[model samples]
Target: MTDMQHKPNGWNLPINQMTEEEWKDYFECRKKYDIKLSDEEIKKIIKIAMHFIDTDHDKYMEESLKIPVPPNLAISYKAFNGLKAMKKFNLSLAKETYPDEF
Candidate 1:
């Protein structure tokens, strides 16, 4: 069997293992935009990044639709809205970083 342990995707680390440098870079890259992402928000971003490493952009978008809306109406509304915005942001970032794939 092929060993997928040392693949290019850095999935071996914990999902939330974003470094300070990564956080800075992420904000810097989007600095011109009006978007602001909190640390909690970045977790979802990282999750999407990891997902894309394993799958393709189209598959990621399709899977995002299946995210369960939160039970609390207020939270559910905000979460869904944030998800939509983040999806757009991530897509743009992906296109810039990996033009061939996105």
Candidate 2:
């Protein structure tokens, strides 16, 4: 099957990368949960989930033995928003030394 034929199973997949069915499911989910997030917020969430987290506790669920269980949307959204805000606050407090990042 082609990539488009593959089902998107995660909330972490970027919006631009989602398949057509995935987009339908995504909108349905957002509507059901009353989630209204900007594209940038969604991107920040994807970035954090894909790049920053070392361990995903959600992957441990036993749903017909699926290896990677998708993270809970409400929890992830709330946590990601708080994390984004906290990181922004922390960055403001940190000293800017030379070569802070390589």
Candidate 3:
């Protein structure tokens, strides 16, 4: 699919093209629990996620799958949120850093 056709879930526009409201909505949707992450923290997490996705997708996926679901739905949801954010941000960074690959 063309880059324009393959946006992250719930993201109709590319990350770079998103408006402030859209960006906020996107992140808010991914936040499944009350746990708040600062913008800087999110950026750091995304950077780490991108590194893992670039250097060791297989291992990352394996480890991600091993994350156990907690008894509390909120906890489980938050974990899912974190993973989803990581993957989405990683894809965005990859596309930016390696445009030819896309």
Best by TM-score: 3
Q: Give the TM-score of candidate 3.
A: 0.25
- RMSD in Å for all candidates: 16.6, 17.1, 14.9
Model 1's alpha-carbon lDDT is: 0.38
Q: Backbone clashes per model, in order?
A: 0, 0, 0
Candidate with more favorable, higher TM-score: 1 or 2: 1
Query: Estimated TM-score per prediction?
Result: 0.24, 0.23, 0.25
| TM-score of candidate 2 relative to the true fold | 0.23
Per-residue accuracy of model 2 over 3-75 as CA lDDT, tens digit each:
3333223324342344467545544432333233455755655565554345664432211121111234323
- Lowest summed lDDT across 10 adjacent residues in model 1 is found at 1-10
What is the full ranking by TM-score, best candidate first?
A: 3, 1, 2
Ranking by lDDT: 3, 1, 2
Query: After superposition, which runs of candidate 1 have C-alpha atoms over 4 Å from their true positions?
Result: 1-33, 57-102
Task: Report the backbone clash tally of model 3.
Answer: 0
Error in Å for residue 3 of model 2 = 36
